[model samples]
Target chain A: MNTETIQSAIHPNQNHPNRNRPPLCFVRHAVWPPPRWGIALETPPGVGMKNWSNEFIGVDWGTTNLRAYRIGCDGGIQESFEDVLGVSAVSDGNFAGIVRELRETLGNLPMLLSGMIGSSIGWRTTPYVAAPASLEDIAAKITWVEPRWTGLLPGISVLTNSRADVMRGEEVQLLGYQSEHGLTQYTICHPGTHTKWAKVRGGKVEDFRSVMTGEQFSLLKEHSLLKAMMHGRVEPDRSFLEAVETGWSGVELTAELFTVRANVLLSRLPECRAASTVSGLLIGMDLRTGLRLAGHDLIVVLGDPALVRLYTAAIEHIGKDCEPAEGATAFVAGMTRIKEMIQ
Target chain B: MNTETIQSAIHPNQNHPNRNRPPLCFVRHAVWPPPRWGIALETPPGVGMKNWSNEFIGVDWGTTNLRAYRIGCDGGIQESFEDVLGVSAVSDGNFAGIVRELRETLGNLPMLLSGMIGSSIGWRTTPYVAAPASLEDIAAKITWVEPRWTGLLPGISVLTNSRADVMRGEEVQLLGYQSEHGLTQYTICHPGTHTKWAKVRGGKVEDFRSVMTGEQFSLLKEHSLLKAMMHGRVEPDRSFLEAVETGWSGVELTAELFTVRANVLLSRLPECRAASTVSGLLIGMDLRTGLRLAGHDLIVVLGDPALVRLYTAAIEHIGKDCEPAEGATAFVAGMTRIKEMIQ
Candidate 1:
């Protein structure tokens, strides 16, 4: 907000526009617009047409997971891929094995890597451009490495809050939104095991936070005692919605939470209603906390729509408004934005 | 309840008590309750009680963690030990190796083990007894073993509304309560990672439900995206209580729940308060859920008063009345009850 604060937000290392880095371990698959400004005049007999090719490819190679996208240049998607194998599998500096495994299906093409794969552990630490950084500043600082075998670029990590973390591919998501939406200021949320909610202004990400909603859900659903209390499937129950409403209002679940299961077990509620009740409690609590502080910020959530719906519905239940960013499109757009900024 | 329903609830196989099974392996420690009562009861040499002679020890070895006590026959505290080890450590039949490590300290002594240590995986799986199985059924069935091996007692497991789970040690806590305090149809709660809220009727634990509060809390605090946002130490912030009071009433948390951290990280709230807010959201939701359902029947939470206070306080926030089972002498009483039943 002030000169000193702004200066601090814009770190010295990332400001050099001329820094020579590979932007990121770029990975994307795209589907373009019907036509593009920079293409040959004739349309192929078998192919469709569009304005400004939007198709692009994206891969969010995080520390624990790998998400790949196939998109049009304008960020329309054609296909997507996911596998349990993550960068964590890349142990003992044998990144070549990982590169071979990841790229085996796709021909050699520019891939954008994000998350921890961009950390010093994954490939190499690409320095992060602090807040107020331009797409150019970020891309220009990419550290390109030609693997004597195959090179995997590590994502960049921002050091603050005394914690170490990398947001390699997410930066691409930020860049893409800036380019497509004409970035001035907006809030973006990318949900997963550890969901990252970020704020960007002037093509720069001002701040961010991470939540472990996905991981918690998985553990509770699979490993915890509460799992048996609910039916196997995620029910679209009314109780579920009520929980979302609670999360939107900022509820915390603790030992006292055991009652959801007890109620279901008691048949005090419909037998099928309990699992949804538990889920609603978790999601509702999340939304409530956010709404209490976030308060109707025009935000774009970049995650699965089902997940987005949970958040959006929770917010709306409490009279707040929200929109969802198509996860795949954001992935491609993010990579494209980085390319535009760098090249 | 109809005759059929009552018959199902009292099914002999379901109600039948467990018998000692030849262990797949042995316990690592020599856990024994002295003839006295397992609690330390030696009077100061200069003080009184040069009169007491017998020694007793009570050990709670459950599915996930283990805690032990050495008490004098008079039921006075002597020594205590604990470890994070639980049945989960052995996914397969590998329980013997693990026990070896934890039990090396206490040379050897007579011990009384309760909870899951009597489970199939703990010391030995005592068979299940049908309902109407009295204290005599339990104490008579207590499997005495070799000096170095732990003698375990089987617990009652309830199958209802399509839910199946076993509670090891809390059964003993309930028994101890009945032994020490004469009661019928009182509620008992043992709070932990998987907290068990039991319904006891006329000196028998009829049914109980396990809540994953502690596990969920640890997961949210340590492994989730929350870990990135936090500094080292964490206080038992009332945010947990607040979240419960404020969280949506009917909803569950299993669905979508990442926004809490996102709101905090974007500095929507101060970092100092994020943990509490998160805690409150989770615990608050939990409290409401617990109160809305079965725990109202919870007359006595049979553990330290602190746990009783924590659980009861949350319920009070929602205008529910609760009593803590602190220092009520349930253990020795439970021992007495079981001993009398055996006699």
Candidate 2:
């Protein structure tokens, strides 16, 4: 890591015995105004870091949020930084500039990048390699950041005779999960703007589906006709079952949608009851679609703890079993496991 | 009828034999100039009648889209007029003047008022009387337009043991429906800005519901997050069923609504598809709830032809049945039935 990052990370309390000599050991801290921003502001790159070695700092280049972690030789964080730089920057015409900032901040350190950085808009499309091959196989062929920093982590393509799908950072998370749990296979779901439900067998994410259900849900309640019938948040109700029942009945959704707002306005139906109705419709459909492909009982979910909780509840309500797998911790753990195989 | 309205409606087609003016009629019509500027042109009341001895007319006042019928001795219309005097004047805070103009044009003849005219913002808030009554019940309580038109039929109301819902012109439609069908029991759905679904048994509306689906749909799709996701008319696979499906499946419509435009950017779920998805969810749930009350048999839908077509397709997909009933025609039949009863 850079020297300024190093000095900021070195605790002031760690004065040397001589009181004038250089000290050792560094710790990652969430200081106000993270260290990177301060370093870029105070000492521009070349003036300092003439004293560091070549090594990676962890990078999370996601579709909507960005963050980074610096690891020392002993695998400890020297610093960490995060921003809402989101992959959306590329969609808005600023991919090259941010890459320059990343290079300047981290200096010459070889970086291990995860997430959408491997996608087409990132540094360079590094095609994803499959799993069960340790970090080296999954490692991007050659992490290349053009002068402009326009690059991406090549996404892993899961395909068979019948289906095909691609995933980026979550693949790393899966690898981290597999290497950590020591399981031959598992089912995982990462929820966000685009929720990915994947099936891992022989330690490879063999297949998956992306559902826009979450996004659709948000739009419907807050922006669509359905919103008119609601008072936003409501006390939990059993009527949620009606929603699921409606889905299973296979009633076409198009024509009937008007009734949600209508019944409530008509006062023939209670407004509060709409919450469960909306929830049941989305989760129920996704569950039905997923079960059709993944064999319901054999699958497990990996997502936000709360979302996982809700997923579990919905599954149980529909006569299925489910549980949550911590995603972030699993990511670091899975990476650590790959670190083992590499050594 | 007011003198001028009687005169304008009478015209001198005497020897031409088509002067066929009805004793009294209540159809509303208006024609507008080019460019849809909404300028209305109506013949002054009494003068036209001076030329033809036996003629009168029925007028319908709405917030927008006005119409009237020139009738024969048997209540047959020899001509008609329609335009956009609509309730915009009142909605625009010009109530008094619009009412005065309406009075001068229609004269003292009996003219019926509905829509916003009965709203607190309209001509006056004419308290509604329960259904199953006739012109006698309504015309008897005419809210006189002083210094102008005198007798105006009041609106109608649906009352249950615990609640009361009212409609003016639609009440007229219901009266028309009850009298014409020759049956005292049926379910009627009036589809418009505020769609009303009513259950009538033994000549009285026993249960009814109002859904603000249309208004909400317009506001959200045009003004909310959904604005970005939309691409003109989206016809769901099975409009109501699929929409209801989403509603019932627990899509979490409310929570996910705000994310629509963002998700559109991330999921690339196709901007065109987003609108249909929203439509599908809301309308689908409406159909589901409606089905709950419709029971398992064929439901006779009293609504617009287009809406009836949608309802028929949705219900049939769910193994239920639908019979289309023209809302306007039913109103006419109901009026005729009531007239026969009175005669």
Clashes of 1: 156
Q: Could you give candidate 2's per-residue lDDT for residues A1-343 as a string of tens digits?
A: 5444543332122332222434332334434343443344335334334322322456677765566655554444555555545564445445555544555554444355678766655555676554333344664353546321222344565434433345677776765677666776666666555566667777667666665556556656776646655554532246565666555455433333544544454466677777666666666665665555567435566755766665666667777666567765565555444333333
Model 1 chain B lDDT-worst window of ten? B15-24
Give a tens-digit lDDT track for model 2, residues B6-104. 334433223322234333333243322112112234433343323222333345556544545443345444444544445543344555454434434
DockQ of candidate 1 is: 0.16
**Is model 1 an incorrect, acceptable, medium or high docking prediction?**
incorrect
Instruction: Provide the TM-score of chain A alone for each candidate, in the order shown.
Output: 0.71, 0.69
What's the CA error at residue A200 for candidate 2, in Å? 2.7
DockQ of predicted model 2: 0.08
Residue A254 local lDDT, model 2: 33
Candidate 2 to native Cα RMSD, angstroms: 12.3
Sorted into a CAPRI-style docking class, model 2 comes out as: incorrect
Top candidate (TM-score): 2
TM-score of 1: 0.55
